[model samples]
Target: MTDVIEREIKIKLDIDPSQLVRNLEKEGFEYLGEEEQEDVYLNGTVKDFRDTDEALRIRVVNDKVELTYKSPKMGKDSKSREEITVNLDNKESMIKILEKLGYKSSYVLRKRRISFRKGNFTVCVDNVEGLGNFIEIEGIDVKESDLVSFFQDFKGKFHLNGEPITKSYLELMVNKLDNSNPN
Candidate 1:
């Protein structure tokens, strides 16, 4: 298992994903390739993950599967949290184990992500299955202010003028689902 502090910022993209990629390339960000990821979010038996602001999920990318635990968001300006991840060899067995332990699957999020890198930061342009496009700038073991500043600089460089979205994709999906099927 590996643990790290995830500090990042997300911005809703107003332009197309290709345009964003081109813009990033022009700004000296090297394209890092694309991948399709499926994330299955699980809820704890005793505590609701949404209420606790924590996350437990299994992410499947290509042939690899990883189980991840994310702590609640910390800083007000950014989504800074402690993330622990463990790679598993058998996805089905791990899922069954978690289910037997009372962790129930809550939501599934799928997206196509194109990654880019410039310096110490990695930028991802994501096209979610249901949700729209978004740009996420992530830095590991970095100060919250520095990350935020980098996000601001990136936004200005790309002529983007949108408020940063701190909510996770799972939260956004849940909200969309709830709104669509109102009780």
Candidate 2:
């Protein structure tokens, strides 16, 4: 079992990831290779996660499966929250267990992620199958007071001109699908 506080920022990018990779390399961030990740989001039996701002997900990355629960963001500036994660031995069994417990599958997100590491922060440039490209900076064990400044410095270093995205990828995908299909 692993429990930690997650402080992060997501920026929607208009530029290509290869370009971003070169830029990050120039700034001395080490390339940490890439991986394909599949995330299955689950809805609670009695509570609507959308309304509660919480998430329960099973993420498969590099043949390993992890069960993660994220609480709602606590403060205003950055997406800082408590994250509890556990490793699962069997993906199929875990899925079946969640299903039996009335946790319905909300959505599945597939993405190709390129990762970089600099100091205590890990940066992921994600190419989501349906939602396009985004850059996310995540720092574990970060102080609450430094959340906003950490994001600001990262944004400045990356020369990210777009506004920071507040919504999660699941929310973005849900909104996109909703907009595409007329009521």
Task: Report the number of the highest-TM-score candidate.
Answer: 1
Q: Count the backbone clashes (under 3 Å) in each candidate.
A: 0, 0
lDDT of 2 at 68: 96
Which residue pairs clash within candidate 2?
Answer: none
Candidate 1: regions farther than 4 A off? none
Q: Give the TM-score of each candidate.
A: 0.97, 0.93
Q: For residues 1-183, could you state the per-residue lDDT of candidate 2 as single tens digits?
A: 889988877889877788999999998999999999999999978888889999999999988999999998775666778999999988789989988988888899999999999888889999999999999888897875675676688878777878777678898999999999999
lDDT of each: 0.91, 0.87
How accurate locally is residue 159 in candidate 2, as Cα lDDT from 0 to 100?
74
Candidate 2 accuracy as lDDT: 0.87
lDDT of 1 by residue, 14-53 (tens): 9887988988888789989999999999997888888999
TM-score of model number 1: 0.97
- How displaced is residue 155 in candidate 1, in Å? 0.4
- Model 1 Cα displacement at 15 (Å)? 0.6
